[model samples]
Target: MFAASVAVLLGAWNNVVITRLPGYPQSYVPVNLAATGLLLAGARFAGTTWQELGLERRRARAGIGWGGVCAAVVAAGYAVALAVPAVRPLLADARLAGAGSGEIAHQALVRIPLGTVVWEEVAFRGVLLAALLRLLPPRTAVAVSAALFGIWHIRPTLSAARANTLADGGAGLFAVVLLGCAVTAAAGVLFAWLRLRSGSLLAPVLLHLATNSLGALAAAAAHRPG
Candidate 1:
């Protein structure tokens, strides 16, 4: 338990550092992958596997199904929100477009891409979640893991708002924090639940990877450059 907790904290700290580094978008992929790799490797070295972690196939299947449904729900909800004028604009920005509005171009750099998705799933959902499950009860572990995952986004949210913070520090930061927590907490629970039930981590990973890919595509298509 102690060791697993230590690993989780280390991963969280690594995210803190990685997300703050220059060229964050690129840096995050490798750093997050590496941390996840180390945790999984450590679990194997310690003789822990899914079976050891209490991941029965039956229960894991339930988790995966529920997780997939939740992921679908979130995606559908976001799609609906984007359809509405009031909130669609919040997530619109050309920076994400990366000079590629063409369908082929947008298809090129979708969030998780095919090649890297598997590796990331192996690392984050597979390794880290398993480690947490070993250290905590299945339900508790999933909840904590989800919360941690949500908090990981805090740095980027704040960094993106540096100017706003400079203009209105506490208010801007508080708003971002509140917003981040609410959204990521829901995402975290869904992802974690999926990971727990699937027992493969690939399910939630694919679910997330697809969300990033399709959501980005949808966002790009829905918003026009102003």
Candidate 2:
């Protein structure tokens, strides 16, 4: 199990770095899909069952009900955040500046859900967490998976830091990356908890969609044309 988990994490790291490389497929949707397939195949080979991996159909109703509530909360939060004068600037990420509606729609609807959300949810909250639960207590499993998930984002966070001036110098960039890791780690815990609580990936999947996709749309809306 340990070896399988390690291999999956390495594959994820590769995905993170490679997908961002020049000449890589745009949106990386196919990459994520392929990675997800391999990850699930590897997990099953390691003896993790669908139920253990949070794929229980019986849990779907609970997942959807709670997930909808959580998603609504997230949407309301984004709406509030976008409405605030001081917070509007934060929502208006400069990276999204001047993006056409089509581009933003692609990002929020297609790129985010398929490219970013699906694989991570499946890998972290599904396969990795399931594998860990077999070896550790529920809390420990969530923590380990969450920590690994956080580490997995380091390369992307570093890349993002380089794209913006928010991280001043080397030290500032380091701080930014560190903070990003911490924030994502915490998010990992939330996601894992949701997965465990509802016994279905649908719970975390819906919440993740709301958190990311809606946030992207909110950011685009908050952005004012100069």
Candidate 3:
């Protein structure tokens, strides 16, 4: 329990760094990598084997395959959402409004996949979930870890809402946070399921990569001038 608490605290710190850091392009890689290292070290200190953390190679192919299926389903949902006019603007990112093709490509292919996706899976599913499983039932661990994962997004979601003015004021911001947490917690359950099913982080990593990359692509597309 102490170890799990430490891990969760570390995750909260990482979230602060991720959302509060300046010079995002310059700071993101180093910040996330350092956080990943801390999570991995914490996992080891908690007596978690690399394999148990889903860091093994034995089921690589199966993990990737299952991840692909999950990504496809998510992509299909995004497509359907995009088809709705009201939903389309929600996908827009003002930051990407003036991004060139190369910038968008780098964001989708490199920045997101290697930076955000990898570190998040390692911290949330790899370390936190592994620790929770030791202290709680599998389903319970998944739920708790997923809830933490959702909570981890609080800062980012609030930052985005503030930047986008998605809400009217304080009450609207509160509602947005609640809604975002609920949705992300549900998504976290799916991610946890992938990790448990494959017994590997590869599956969740791939799913995350697909979700972020595809979502960035959609945001870029939406922000582009007609």
Q: Candidates 1 and 3: which is better by TM-score? A: 3
Pairwise lDDT winner, candidates 1 and 3: 3
What does the lDDT come to for candidate 3?
0.82
Candidate 1: residue 136 Cα off by (Å): 2.7
lDDT of 1 by residue, 1-226 (tens): 6446644564566346655767766665565566556656676787777654334465556556655775687678777867777777665544454446664353435335542454445544565666666667877776766666666667645655563342376886778776866686677677666665555464576577656666666666556643
lDDT ranking of the models: 2, 3, 1
Q: Model 1, stretches more than 4 Å misplaced?
A: 1-15, 19-28, 50-87, 101-124, 160-168
Task: Please give the lDDT score at residue 163 for candidate 2.
Answer: 66
- Candidate 2 lDDT, tens digit per residue, 1-226? 4546553665466436656666575737777778789888987887788898888889999889878999999999988887788887777766677899999999999978987888889988998788777778989888888888778888878876786566888899999988988988899999999998888999999999999999888878887832
Give the alpha carbon lDDT tens digit for every residue of 56-82 in model 3. Answer: 888788788899888998899778767
Q: Cα-based RMSD of the predictions, in order?
A: 4.7, 2.2, 2.4
In model 2, how large is the Cα lDDT of residue 103? 95
Q: Against the hidden reference, what TM-scores do the models get? A: 0.68, 0.91, 0.88
